[model samples]
Target chain A: MVLHIMADALFISVAILTIGSAIVALETRELVYGAIGLAISMMGIAGFFLLLDSPFVAMFQITVYVGAVAVLVIFTVMLVRTQALFSIKEDPRRKTAGIVLLLVFIGGIGAVVLASGLGNPAFTKFNKPAIDVATIGKQMVTYYAPVLVLLGLTLAASVIGALALARREDIEQKNERVD
Target chain B: MATVPEEFRFGNFLASIIWVILIVIVLLTLVILPLTFIVLFYVPLPPVNGEVLTPYLFLTMIVDPTRTLPIVKYLIHTTPFKVIVFPGFVFAAIIAAATIFVERKFLAKMQLRVGPLYAGVWGVGEGILQLAADGLKVISKEILIPSGADKPIFWAAPIAFVATAAAVVALIPVAPGWVVSNTDVGLIAVFAILGFFPLIALLFSWASNSKYPFIGGLRALHQMIAFEIPFILSALSVVILAGSLNLTHIATSQHPFWFILFLPISAFVFFISSLAELERVPFDLPEAESEIVAGWLTETSGMIYGLIQLGSYLKVYALAALFVILFLGGWSGPQIFPHQLGPPDAIPLVKVLTLQGLYNAVTVNAIFWFLVKTIVIIMLMLLPRGISPRIRIDILLHTGWYKLIVLAFVNMFVALALIYAGVLGPGGSLSIH
Candidate 1:
């Protein structure tokens, strides 16, 4: 009983941290801080995934979210000139409204949770774990495999199109230089 | 003077311990789940089934149903404690230290010279002793928060990165039934987690607020999107062939013939995609040290740098382990022992252990075979890293979008054709009416 309570508490805490950090990441004035917030938010989401009984998802959340996405945001921040940081606009009214709305939203969620505790709604359990790589492939090929193949073709077309678009510019630049 | 209140200190300390405990639980569960099956099947006289693959059938014979749950349950119950933390941390550190020693020596040998010959044990412990020394060194050194850097992000990044990589091992089955939580979405989970790595490095670079790191981050992001498509799609090929996503089933599916034998191109794509995803060698544009001054990690120091390196190496190992499972028959070895001796799983732990012993053997599994496979892939990656030299960004974009993407499509068709042609299994026959 005590363990379950602690688990629930930890889950709620991590969820709050994740959502709060995400908001901060999205809303912060300083780009660097916002990226940091994004990393924290990603970590929080990873924690939430852990509570969802999918440790793998949590790991992905951390690796891709904190490891990859946050880093990209930070990189973008660096690429833009520091002078731009000064020029960046901040909307105080919108910020205030966002915070107010966010607080109310959180409060409402808390109320709902309190009103109805987490109760297991019995769902048909799988004989084995599902959504593994092989199963996904099986389902894709047997059922949705064509869709995956179509997506692959579309991707190829787009790539070729991009290359062609890029090469045209190169040709135009060369023509200008030669002329 | 420390002005923080006593209660706050206690609370923080408690929280830290709790975090450690939680982490340990997750780790134990992940690492030991597969071993459970291996243990369960360690019992009696082997069966005589001519068609059954000797290793698994042998495993089934020896499987003592009585022993399966105890160890698994025990590990699960006790994992959430500090006791396990020390061992887990040590195991990771020891592997890291061993890799350093092996790499240094190997690099030296590759260059035709003795490496670290003067160190303790005449280079035997070359960097092994240095592992502890380095730990102390990192701890004592000042933690630098560069100008314009977000202090919290800089501090938290390494912890989050290392912790996630460590957590991934729980899903990886070392031996049969030795897993943490055998979730259905294991493959999706791995890919999803792996997808985040370059992004984290990008964040690190961005947090540094440096020029080169910024460029590196941008290149990484572009490469990430470029590579992720082929990587995920190729994995789909394996999934398609197997008709199941659960890793255990995936392994079991390969009992007749390894998936690679049936779909070699898919295997190749998966391997290459893994290399790119790991950001090693040719694909390691994000941290092209000579060009970008260590790219995303320009400003990191001491333990933080160590963590990044460790995480990167582990990623390589993780990828290789996945390859072994998905394509190469994981824990599936040619049977030398007679089947009449015992039941498959009930085969004494030693006999079963001997089959998987190379995989679980500390130096062998952790260093030799693991390192060899990863290094080969890394070498393949290196061939392109600087050997081919850096292409223009447009060229990089072109190759991925045009060449590799098209090749991946062709590869899929080949796989599909092969499957239909009865090359993959007995049932499928390509009939021309």
Candidate 2:
């Protein structure tokens, strides 16, 4: 009983932290701070994954999102013009549109949750053991192999495309030198 | 401004000490005792020796020396004990401290100099106490923050670094069942924890708001991120060989032969990538002292710097231990430890003194071997600092992205070939289980 209460409290706290950081990310003026806030929010999401008893997913969330993506965002933010980091020119129209979009998102999420029966006690209760990494790996190989391969190919292609885009200026400079 | 203060007085010092002691005693009696009593009243106590242990019984056990063994045994098995004492913070910290001293002495010898000669007992150990002295000095020194620095992150980054390092340490198994947090995906969890270091570095440098630190932070980001792929890929080969992600299981899987025998290229790649991840020697561009003024750590002073060093050395210990666990057949050695320390019918007092209940010969042997292998690996890691200069950033990135990844992939194929050839893995020719 005590453990359950503690778990609930932990869940509530993690939810608060995630939401608060996400808000901070959106609201903060400094781009670097926003990036850090985003990282923290992702960490909170990882914590949620931990609460859901999917530590593998939690670790992956941290590794990919907080570790790589957020760091990349921060790096780019830091490299930009210092003056631009703190400046956000607010418009009334944009703010109204943002609020409308947010409300629509929240409503859509709420509708999905209601329709999916996630609110039901039976649906929420997890009696089965969490899936192990080995089982997941096996499933990936046997069942989801094509999807996995496609995902890998997409990621690889994107990486190559990004490299090409980044190196275009260098290539042009080299051509000029040759001329 | 240069005015001299009054001379020190022994009487005044004594009086001040007495006053402080009196205040502490008063606080203990008035505030702390009641708080403890109130807290203990509501808290559930565990049974000791099949008896419910109340506050009175706890006090009695404290007073009666004979009844203390059970309590000690119980305490040893507690989560706090595992996390704080064995296989956790204290253990890792001690290893980190030792590594620091050893690195200093080892590097000094390599550079043809005597290191830390004034700290040990009459120079008998030649500087064994240097770490203690350094710790004291750093703790006593003032922490300096730059004027426009982000105060919160500047203060928090060092602590976060250490905490992250400790989290990684908690996942590592010193001996069988000796890990603090024994997760199923321990390898992935380690990689996850390691991913935070670069973030911490960048944040700290940004907080510092200095040119050099900014450059250093970017280098750290690039270096750590570039090497991460190779690090994961190299470990993936080990994972493929072991067919389990749990570090303990991986270690135990190598009972018949170490993974290095089969995946030498993976081991080599792992070592190099770990060096890059750790930012040691040939990969210490982030903290290249001559070029970048301590890199991301430019603004850190006193205990802040100390904490970062401690974190990095803890990282060094962790990665070296990981390498040992992955490739060197962790804790598998000749049975040097006896089945029992003394006669089985020895006196209870002798048994208690030797901690017979807690001490297993097998565990002791495992720990000894693990430590020995980890130390050797650590020494190997330190050796590069003495011989090689730090590489350029572009070269470091290129090596991490191109060479190490290719090497790791080559070994992954080799691991696959072995698995298919029935040389290892389930029901294979050389499989132990």
> What is candidate 2's lDDT per residue for B110-143, written digit by digit as tens?
8999998989986499988999999999999999
Clashing residue pairs in candidate 2 (N, C-alpha, C atoms within 3 angstroms): none
Error of 2 at B134 (Å): 1.4
The CA lDDT at B73 in model 1 is 32
Instruction: Give per-residue CA lDDT, model 1, range B85-167, as digits (tens).
Output: 32234344445456556665666666677766543646465444654565678777776667988676677778867766765
Clashes of 1: 65
Give the C-alpha miss distance for residue B319 in model 1, angstroms: 1.7
Q: Scored by CA lDDT, what does every candidate get?
A: 0.64, 0.92
Model 1 lDDT per residue over A101-156, tens place = 98999999988976775443443333454233444446777889789999999999
Number of the top candidate by DockQ? 2
